[model samples]
Target: MDSVDLQVLAAARRWAAEGRRFAWVTVARTWGSAPRPPGSWLALRDDGRVEGSVSGGCVEDDLIARMRGNRLGGGQPFILAYGVTQEEAVRYGLPCGGTLELVVEPSPDPAQLEDLAARLGQHQLTQRQVDIASGTVTIAAAERGDALSWDGGRLITVHGPRWRLLIIGAGQVSRYLAHMALALDYEIIVCDPRKEYGPGWDVPGTRLVTTLPDDTLFALEPDARLAVVALTHDPKLDDMVLMEALKLPAFYIGAIGSRLNNAKRRDRLARYFDLSEQELARLRGPVGLAIGSRTPPEIALAILAEMTAVKNGVAVPLRDAVAEP
Candidate 1:
C-alpha cells in the first residue's frame, strides 16, 4: 500500500470511532492497464467524502454518485465489478480493456482496523484475511515475502513498510529524496554524522540519523527490500558506506558521482577493498535515468524514479540508466 492507502486506512478508523458509517473500498482484482493494483484502498464516508481511488477517476465518481443517492453499500459487505463489457469499459474510460473488481466493507470493526493501522505504521508485516461469507476479519503476522492472495470466498492482503531506504547524506538531494520516498510508502532514514550536514536535519516523516554511514549500514541489517544511496559526493564518506553496503542484501546500492569518477571509484574499490566484479556490478553509479537533471530536486527525482523502476522489477536500459556521471 502507498501513503494514500495508509491515509484511507487511518481515516476509516477515525470515521468508525465517530460512529459514522462509511464504505471501505478495495481493488480486489484488476484486468489490463488498471491504474491501481490489487489491495489498493479508498475510504468513503457516509456523507459522500472519499479518501482514495480504485480507478483513475471515473470509478470513484460513479461510486460517489451512488453514495449521494443512498444506493451504495450499507447493511452488508458487497462486491462491485466495473467495466465488465466493452460498452461499459468505453463508458468508464477504462484503458486497454481495464476492469476492476472491488469489495466494499461497510461498518467494519473499528478496534481491528485501528490495531492494523498501528501495527502497519510500526513497520510490521500484517496480513488481513476477510471472509466474505461470514463477514469475519482476522489479522495476523505475515512473512516479508507474502503477497496479496484472494480467493472467491476470502481475501488476504498484506500490509507493512515495503521498502527501507538509507540515504547516506543529509544534504539537499537527500531532503528531496526523503520527501518523495514518503509518498511511495518507503521508510527513509537520512544518515550523516558530520556536524555540518547532519545537524538540524528536518524533513517530515523521515528519520535523521547522526551515525557514520558504514556503522549505519550494519545497524540497518539491510535486506533485499532496502536501498542505500550515497549522496555526500565525498569519497571518504561515500566509499566507506558503499564498501559495507555492497556486501549486504540491499537490492540497490548507489552513489552520486560521474561516470569517470565511478570508474575510478570502482577501480579503487577493486584494488584496495578487494571487491569482486560481482560485488562491483551491484553498485549503481551515475544513478537515476538519463534525464539531464542538474538541480538538486531534479536529481533527487531522477534517483527515486530509477529506484521505483528497480523496485517494480523493471529493467532499465543501460543507455537510459546513467543520468549523470
Candidate 2:
C-alpha cells in the first residue's frame, strides 16, 4: 500500500474508535488517465468529512455532495464508475476520456479496519478481503512476492509499510540515507551496537535500534520490498548482518566498502559462511550508483537512486554501476 492508503486507513481506525460511522472508497481500476492509482483510498465520515483522495477534487466533491444528501447512507457496498465518456473525462480532469472505477463500501467494518491498521503498524504485509454482497471481511497474511489481486466477490487489498530499509550502521552515511529514505516513504530502521555511533541517532520517520546488526536482521526478516546496507565498515558489526541479509529475500543488499575491502569481505564470506557464488553475486559490494559520490550525502543519494531503480525494475546505467575514482 502507498502512503495515501495508509493515511486513510489510520484515519478510518481513529474515526471507528470514536464510534463514528464512515465508508471507504477505493480506486480499484482505471482506464486511460486516472488521478489516483489502484489501491488509493478515501475515508468518508458520516458528517461528509473526508481524509484521503481518489480523484482530482471533482469526484470527491460529488461524493461529498451525495453523502450530505444522505443518498449513500444505505448500507450497501457497490462499485461506481465515472468519466465513461470523453467529455465527461475531460470535465472530471481525467485526460483523454479516461474512466475510473471505485469500490464504495458503506459503513466499513470497524474490526477489519483496526486489524489492517495493526498489521500495517507492525510492518507486516497483510491482505484484506471484502465480500461485496455479504459485507464480510477476511484478513490473511500476504505472500511476500505476489501482487495483490481481486477475486470474485472479494477485493484483496495489500497493507503494510510500502518499502523498508535496514541500515546496518548509524553513521553520517546512514543518517543521510535515512533522511532520503523517509522522504521516499520508506520505513527505515537503523542498527548500530556501538554506543559512540548509536548516540544522538535522531531521524524523523525512522526507528533507531541499538541492537547487534545480525540480530536486527534476524528480527526484521527482510521482505522483498526491503533493502539492507552495511555502512559501519566493521566486520563484526557489518559482516554478520550482510551475510544474513544476503540470505533473505530483500530486493537490495549492499555493503559500503572499498573495492579491495569488498573483495576481502567476499573472500571471508565464501571461506567462513559457505556463501555460494550466486549468493555472493547478489551482494552489491561497493554499494550505490557511481555518480562520483565523494561525500556522505552524495553517496546516500546514489544508493537511494539505485534502490529506487531496482524497486521499479529499471536497469541502472553503466555510469551508475561504478563510482568514479
Candidate 3:
C-alpha cells in the first residue's frame, strides 16, 4: 500500500463515522497500460464526494456520476470494467488500449474497515476477501509475500507494509528518513545502543532497538524485502553492520557518507574484511540520489527517491556517476 491508498482509507473511515452511505471501489485487474496499478482503491460517497482514484480522470467522472445517481452498485458487490474496446478506450482516455476491471461494494461494513485499519496500525499484514455475489467479507492475517488475488467471483486483497527498513543510528537523517518511510509502506526499525541518542529518538511507527549494529543485523536475518541503511557515520558501528549486510540478499543496503569516505570504506572492507568484489559491489555508498541535498530532510527525500526507483526496477545512474570520483 502507498500513501494514496492510505489517504483513501482515512477518508473512507471519516465518511463512515459521519454515517454517510458510500461504496468502495478497488482496481482488480488491468491490461496493456494503466494509470494506476491493480489493488488501488477509490471511495465514493453518496453525495458525489469521492476519495482516491482508479484511473486518470474519465473513469472517476463516470463513477462519480453513477454514484450521485445511486447506480454504482445494487445490494451486493459487482465487477465493473472500463476501456474494453478501442472506442471505449479512446473515450475513456486510456492509453494504448488499456483496460481496468474494478470491484465495487455498495455497502462496505464500517466495522470490518476499522478492523483492517487497526491491524495495519499494528503492523500486521492482513488479507481481505470479498465475495462478489453475497457481499460477504472476511479479514485474516496475511504473509509478507501475499498479494492481491482476484478470481471471477472472489477478490482477495493484501494490505499493510510488505517491506521493512532497518536504520542504523537514530541521528538527524534517520529521524527524517524513518518518518517519511512510513508512508511508503515500510515497517521501520531504528537500532542504536548509544544512550545519548535513545532519549531523543521518538518517531512513531518505528521500533527502536538498543543493540549494537552488527548484533542487530545478525538478529534481523534480512531477506530480499528488507533494506538496511547505515547512518551513524561511525565506521566502528557502520562498518561492522556492513560486513554482515553485504553478504545478505537484502534488496538495498546503503550507507550515507562522502564519496571519499565511501571509497575508503570500500577499500577497508575489501582489504581487511575479505569482502569479494562482487559483495562490495552490492553496497550503495554515498547513498541516495544526487539531488544536491544539503540538509537532513532533503537528504531523507533523496534517499527514499533512490530507494523507490531501485525497488521499482528503474535503472539509476551508478554511484560513481553521481558522486565525485
Task: Highest lDDT: give the candidate number.
Answer: 3
Clashes of each: 2, 1, 0
Candidate 1 lDDT by residue in tens digits, 44-127: 887889998888788998888888788776556678899999877877878888888987787677888988988887778899
- In Å, residue 29's CA in model 3 sits off its true spot by 1.6
Instruction: Give the candidate order by descending lDDT.
Output: 3, 1, 2
Cα misplacement distance, residue 255 of candidate 3 (Å): 1.1
- How does each model score on lDDT? 0.84, 0.82, 0.88
Q: Candidate 3 residues 70-168, lDDT tens each?
A: 797566999999999999899888899999999999989899889988998876779999898778999999976788899879999988755789999
Q: After superposition, how far is residue 137 of candidate 3 from its true place, in Å?
A: 3.0
| Best-fitting candidate, scored by TM-score | 1
Candidate 2 residue-wise lDDT, 77-125, digit = tens = 7888889888778777777688888888887888877777778888777
| Lowest lDDT 10-residue stretch of candidate 2 | 316-325
Better of 1 and 2 by lDDT: 1
Clash pairs (backbone) in predicted model 3: none
Candidate 1 versus the native: TM-score? 0.90
**Cα-based TM-score, every candidate:** 0.90, 0.87, 0.81
